[model samples]
Target: MQDEGIGSNEVHDIISAMDEHFNPRDLKVGQDVQMHFEPGADEGSYQLTDMRIELNPLKTLTVSRTDDGFKSNLEEKEVKEVIQAQKAVIKSSLYGSAAKAGIPKTVVSDAIKIYSQNVDFQRDVQSGDTLEVMYETHQTEDGYIAKTGNVLFAQLTLSGRKIPLYRYETADGSVDYYGRDGQSTKKTLMKTPIDGARMSSGFGMRRHPVLGYGKMHKGIDFAASTGTPIYAAGDGVVQRAGRFSSFGNYVRIRHRSDLDTAYAHMSRIASDVRPGTRVKQGQVIGYVGTTGRSTGPHLHYEIMVGGKQVNPRGVNLPVGQQLAGRDLKKFKAVVGEVDSQYAAKSGAAVKVAQRQVESQDDIN
Candidate 1:
């Protein structure tokens, strides 16, 4: 206000009023500020009649002179929630193609993660495949997106097979993505609980490196750099956490009846993960390290079934909850709604594509 050449007392009053709504110091560059002034009763000075600052596309803060003093208020632009459908051919990768199709990066990443249980991006996705996604967003009246919601529906076609999934909430208030057959997309456990690691050893009989004798390797070993985060394979209560002889920094979780997963040779265990503590799937339980009777930095991961260690790769894990009866009916209704909305927006999408092509042709 001083830079604008207002009188010191008047500037103080105006800024004080503005501070009641928002701090002027919090303003960012490129944010527009408009000031309207009227001639004061004296010829030498001008009165600040109105002041407006654009906070965002949907919100504005304004200060106007009132009978009592300067008054500040916030103005909100009209916003509405809308469903947007986007589809693209996979020329390279799902992330790239979805981005070109106008899907938000966050939504693309989230959709990929949800589908990772069923689809391998490197192996399953190929050129000429197609992806269709429908999601919700809160947008301004002029179509500026304010925020986005989860993918309501997603479809990926590989070769001649098409997989369609819908976001559904169960009567028990749990939400998860489900296929057309009402089966959840989540598995009992993640195939690999750690990210960016390679399997160094298999779960089978081998010559024990430390013992120098033939022995059963009860767990799989993932070679990773020290401090790489290790995640819990499934939601379970920690049955035990601590050092145990050769299994240094061991943490075991009991997931289900006769099912338990264990992580050993951890550099550090998560502070909150202890015996009897419940942890959700994908929760970080520890970090990889060569803490046990091992030769190098790696994670010793084991899945025990019926008190016997099993091969993690060959284990037949169970699928998540299946919607049946009334729940299935409701899920199908949701799927139908998503399909209708996608079809409704198909024409609009085609027009947009055509307009872009025509504009490019004109430029060329």
Candidate 2:
């Protein structure tokens, strides 16, 4: 190769222009070659600060772009407005009654309290009852009753179709339960023996435990957890009990007249339980378990009348005691107020309803 003998000034300028390009003449004919160059200001090249990369302000969900420089799935949300839903007002009215137009009291009372455990209108009711209720709805963010409230005016119907009501004040007030005809359901004892407790098994069935064979189950089985207390099925005095072979850990009670009941297969009997002990209905008699000749855990219950076992869970299961005359009238009045409560937009009340859900981050 011939030396060009270029000017010293030209050589100096070339080295200054490209500092990293040292071996520049290593090219061969028809050979592959690669070269990297740093952009310069003089040759329309830009520094990093001068170069611009356009970016969209919105978030994109598409991995591949379309021909139009936009993805098919990129949705643009329009910012309109958000309206806070208002709740309907809560009002107190007749829930049920035997008077004219009304549902059964027991069924309605059971239905109303289901929402909030704390309700005051439960008291003051009789078997043959009637009621009348009056109350106003409130205004709330989601509406009024949508917010949740107590009884406004409770009108309890009595035996003679008399209605007595206790008004519920909105501004932090005490709740009072009363009956129509100026009567009260709040007595020393409740009418129903069992309230929330569920019956695991009923009297009369086909099952065996000791021999592991199918046999006639004479009594009912209340399958509660081990250590769960068993209540006396009725008001009775403890009779024959203690430890029996087949009826392992039993408690027999003699009730009024010719009625009697027995609880067996108990893990343990209460210390208070003994012969001649007077027990009330719903009182703890024993704990449920797989004692005696039992296959699994259960409460063996039996109800005897005139010294004979009968179906305790018969459809005609007896109520604690039915009230009549003035007592019945007062109960119906309370039911009246509970029935009208549905007027407060709880879904069936409104023609159109929308449920709103907000994330914690969004709400704040």
Candidate 3:
């Protein structure tokens, strides 16, 4: 029997009603639960009529107690999906320009992640540089955004060079962003591993600042504030992550059979970072500091090849994967789709801008 607060006194009916779809113990605090009750034939007794529970934004479960037992049903809801595209010119920073253009922070962050493989946003992006983004936003029918969707495509025009990337997935279920030529943007190692830092020193024979004598500077130095994050140059296992005599807090990662990178003068090493711990590219391994020797806060970075220190900026790093065979065929189709989408969206934006300008002219 259904207990709608009707004349059903049987506890078995209430148990049966909940057993079909949901457990009463699993109910959350913010969820809505409704119960219907009515007077029974006897003054002292009541009957249970019906009950409803909102499962989530898109679904609801309802139970009705009847003479036979409890009947249960699920109700579905409808939502709307909105597509958005935006463009902006860099004035101060990418974040500021994107915000001014009404681009969501999450989407802007995604764009930066995609571009970080090659462009150093901290260094490369300048005033007058342009950025374009095409993405989607999921919203309820009531116009409230539920969440942001993927960055379908993004383009960064920096210093007259237009770098365009399209999001695509390989047939093997791997997804990544690729250039217009179907080559991946991600490389074997990142050039500038740290964010918001400048090259204070380069690899060469120079007088050591603390040692006060002419010596070969094996590693490059990036001057940054203490506690700035330091990332792994590539996917590698930690070879060393601890304090040393002159290096202070130091970390070394082995990327290949012949390749390795080292970071010195860290405020603190990431707790999870240790010898034999595998770290991916861009994973924060430590923070900047002047821990070991005499110097202001900075990161002493080194790239070693075959046991010899090499210039990171000089080494020709292996480029990202090139799509071929079936993958290439699939990627070409994706490129076509992205181009069409971008063109359509850009055209629409241009028309809107032109209309606005014409209207302004008429007003003037």
* Highest-scoring model, TM-score: 1
Native-to-model Cα distance after best TM-score fit, residue 236 in candidate 1, in Å: 4.1
Which ranges of candidate 2 are over 4 A from the true structure? 1-207, 212-216, 222-224, 313-319, 338-364
lDDT of each: 0.85, 0.47, 0.83
lDDT by residue for model 1 (1-364), tens: 6788788998888889988779888999878889998889988888889999989888899999999989999999887998888888889767788888888876786676566667656566789999888888988888888889878888889996999989999999978889988998876577677765778888899999889999999999989999998888877899999897788999999988788999999988999999999987767899998887988889999999987899987875774778999999999998888888888896789998899999999999
**Per-residue lDDT of candidate 2, residues 155-226 (tens digit):** 334345544333322123423333333332222122223233345555555655466667777776755667
Report, for all candidates in order, the number of backbone clashes: 0, 38, 16
What lDDT is obtained when candidate 1 is compared to the true structure? 0.85
Per-residue CA lDDT of model 3 for 268-359, tens digit only, reads 99999999999877789999999999489999999999989998878856646788999999888988987888888878888988999999
For every candidate structure, what is the RMSD over all alpha carbons to the true structure, in angstroms?
A: 4.8, 21.7, 7.8
- Model 1 bad stretches (over 4 Å): 1-4, 29-31, 36-49, 65-69, 88-97, 194-232, 235-237, 241-251, 263-301, 307-311, 359-364
Displacement of residue 143 (Cα, Å) in model 3 is 7.5
Tell me model 3's lDDT, rounded to 2 decimals.
0.83
Please give the distance, in angstroms, between residue 346's alpha carbon in candidate 3 and its true position after superposition.
3.7
Rank order (by lDDT, best first): 1, 3, 2
| Model number with the top lDDT | 1
TM-score of 3: 0.68
Reference-based TM-score, model 2:
0.39
